[model samples]
Target: MNTNKSGPQENIDLGNSKVVNIRDKFDNKTKEILAKRVGYLCSNPDCKNTTSGPHTDPKLTINIGVAAHITAASPGGPRYDSSLTPSQRRDSSNGIWLCQNCSKLIDSDTNYYSKDLLQGWKHNAENHAKQLIERELNQGWATTLPEYFESLISLELTTSPPIGRNIGQSSDGQFWLVLWDSRNAKYQWSKITEKYAEQELQSVCKYRNVTNWQDLFEK
Candidate 1:
């Protein structure tokens, strides 16, 4: 039996009341830019809710809304580009407005950590971001599967081309393809797929003999 309890007051205040710990003024600008870019709504195409909720914990670490950086400014990233004005370099094309769940989805995948999605989202959201800066931003948006696909395509294919087919998503609806990139460690696409996507999923599952997914398609 557990006697001790974690009260709501037990949580430490990080000084800011915002869901995401956006402290830096630059990051705040980034957030504002994203909010404008995404129209202050959730980025999932299927979810029309305002992005005014708590984001579940990602990495199973802490419970907070993780504001996703469309282009992660991590090590070995394209952060040193000399082609743009400093402001353009620090603009909304470099990021996105994903709710916590979608944020987690972004974190759990490589596409998020790649250039493909970053550039794709940039191209996709360019108009919106432009309007956002112009103060003509709307407040209605949701992330869609096409955005996901375009992002994946934005990846900088390695010198050695990455292995994996553009097959469809899983049926029980866990993954997008039979194997989440047989070339890399397995990670699944949480979003569901349609009939065409299902056919693609089965073909790859059978071709790769993805044990579980292959059997699922046979039926």
Candidate 2:
């Protein structure tokens, strides 16, 4: 008889690997850990998509990155940056918990948040809201959009009387998914920001590889 010694998974060893370019630390460990903390999804107030990976256009950790440090490091630190040399780096408070899209928004402008909103958001992330891009911005009249909108105008929303996520028959008598499109309501994934059942997502959860919400919810 013969046996082989156990070896660690390649992803788990990312913290010590020398291949920085080839191996993404965040994907290997940091993402795994942070996802657990933030419920394996975007931490935005209303958005609720499970995060498959971590991002570092802003660095969260030195290696096995999860949260990006808003401030750049010194010349010879874990991630040296010439551009950051002149400017003072910010502390963790300056950093925001963002998904890939939100991270881009932050980089696009120094004044990303409204002055009144920014101060309140910084005071506590719980008070903040996830801002969508122009395309998905809450607006009116789109020639091409989801068909479910039409059904929503007429269909009133109702929950299953607070089973688990139902939160108990909303205080407003009933909880219904309102179709903003007001054109077609056959099927539309509403509230991309808030955490939702896997099935609630359209193509967004393409990687989920699950047949329906039960796949993740039963867990």
Candidate 3:
């Protein structure tokens, strides 16, 4: 005497159903963009797992990644923001790339992984991907120096008694010495040669009494 229809049904109410679960899911384009922006790596800094690889089938590939929502796609979900609209919730800006495990972990423990923290991870992951792409395009010349050198340049420009100076090579294989002088409140770039790069950087560090300058580049 039981009659229940099986197959795709449009919001079938089974007696106790008072509410419908509607999720603002991302479209295929948004998912692909999110994956590419992070280079298909997990956004979790501690767990940057490669999420894509080749499958046994030559034409097929296995993807263990997901475009996870920074804020929940629906109400009562993890990190749900009441302020965001339906369109905003499904936008690429609200997405982050993560592996299956990390996507589940973030949802399971929303307290530890707040909205801001996830946003930071997304920002960093995107930046890392950009740097990688730049390096590849420039034939590795874009990353001749430690990545921290870029941040150091910015820090030295605003601080007193500038101590950050380094020599970097350009994409065209030309070397240049970058110097920051706090007295003038300006930085200067002078052309130099590859052989003098290390020597000049060391000399500048020594004059500035930066004994542990190498630590600046440590991860």
Candidate 4:
């Protein structure tokens, strides 16, 4: 069936599929779970974009995400599976959280984005959500991993004698480790020295009274 663009208006053929009458819609609970499963970010691994944010108007909010179906929501549409029941078609397992751009991109290229691949994306998104929840439950790190890591890298670039580079986590899950080295006026770092760096980082943290070397994973 043709995709619905505007309210109750006539369905327009978007040239991807032939227009039909049936419409498979997801219920509220399913939609909510789909959004939460990905932590409200685009499921596309290359585009983990946050879908919602503060709006220009303080009282409003902006959302650029969509809960797209792995299989077409209606028959005669892209990736429509005739084998699935109507209820199965609308199930949360069939949905993927995605930015508006990625949503359209997947629908536009059904050949490349198969149901199995989309399902894998959904699984990956859920795994990421689990990791996020675990991180949040831990004594609340100051920032997300990527953000914190990028900031550390930035600090490494600007500093002259990048010493004291290390990685360490607090007993309460506060993980922050960074160090840089400027040898012979040339920059050298231990981004690859993760194993050794951890040992050094813990020693540094202990020296600074930051956190001990005990196994404190009881959170």
Candidate 5:
């Protein structure tokens, strides 16, 4: 007779005190939440590695982020928690987003990565993403031409849309134009004078949309 009590199959025990072929799997919803919550970046503070990027195939993207459990999903595994229910084991709150390398490293060095420490990492990563989004929103529109260009690139990696608009005079006092792309929401800007930039931006709002050039300056 199998003495092992029934539970999630991932940590099942065979007869005669033998535990074999255990597995713990996170549901698709849990996986999605873990990845999205951390902005698809590795949760390691020192690494801060990008988990997804443009792939060699132009039409494809690569994702390397892993949702690793804070406590092992199965018995006899690193940081294994026999006390947790199967549902609790697979919860998003019990997971952390990590790069492939960091995932292996944590599991191998279980002594250093306690459940509490992994929870702290998760908290920090999510808070970091939230702060970046807040900064982008609070920045409003860029006031100067140079500031506009810089802000556009700086915000591309964060959760914000990274859309910025600016109209200002340059050092030479030429009219500066910065437009947001309606199709893709990309920030488009040019250092050339107003006449040259009109053709480049190809804006539908060119002549009919403006009250006055002087009134367009973004603060």
Candidate 6:
């Protein structure tokens, strides 16, 4: 019925009795940090929709993003870890920004959206935000798709590669490809024409069955 700075306080009815459901929800500050870190984008790589936009009222803004918990905020919830304390549950590190749909999707399916997977998504999303900021500071505009593939190749070499493939890029501003071998943790890359980069990216996307090529850059 009443809420405080700590978290939400509510009562739930069960049969003939009422019980309190005190979830360790993120505070306003924590939610802001999570949203800012991801540049207000949904952390789901496949669904990187912008979560905030202008409203008809100049004084107001609309937000469709949710600061979701990586681990459940309460008992018997999806990915709930009893080992975590209430403070830990409410911490920013345990939160991920997502659209309303994705927030519900993750909670509904715990097996496919494991804690590790969500963590990965958070890391990638934050890194993407950082890169975007850095790119704007270093250059005037966002990196072109080909340049993005080139950076992916560089990222692959520095970290874990995908599976069963070797990748490369070209200097002629043509194209690039990157492969990740999760088993061996090895990466192979080369330079090719821009046309080849598109083809290779399509091939890799098909292999991984992912709609977004940016998902491949996940470490």
Ranking by TM-score: 3, 6, 4, 5, 1, 2
Instruction: For candidate 5, give the lDDT of residue 88.
Output: 85
The 10 consecutive residues of candidate 5 with the worst lDDT sum are 148-157
TM-score per prediction, in order, is: 0.33, 0.26, 0.66, 0.57, 0.55, 0.61
**Count of clashes in candidate 3:** 0
Per-prediction tally of clashes: 11, 21, 0, 5, 0, 14
Note each model's CA RMSD in angstroms.
18.8, 20.7, 8.6, 14.0, 12.7, 12.3
lDDT of 2 at 122: 36
**Per-residue lDDT for 139-185 in model 5, tens only?**
53222224223222121222334354544355555655565544454
Q: Residue by residue across 68-127, what tens digits does model 6's lDDT show? A: 999998887889998998999999999999999999999888999999999999998988
Error in Å for residue 135 of model 3: 0.3
Q: What is the C-alpha lDDT of each candidate?
A: 0.46, 0.35, 0.75, 0.66, 0.67, 0.75
Give lDDT: candidate 1, residue 9.
Answer: 50
The full ranking of all candidates by lDDT, starting with the best, is: 3, 6, 5, 4, 1, 2
Which residue segments of model 3 deviate by more than 4 Å? 1-19, 143-147, 150-219
Candidate 6 regions exceeding 4 Å error are: 1-20, 140-219
Candidate 5's C-alpha lDDT? 0.67
Winner on TM-score (1 vs 6): 6
Please give, for residues 144-177, the per-residue lDDT of candidate 1 as tens digits: 2332332221111233334333443333433343
User: Model 5 TM-score?
Assistant: 0.55
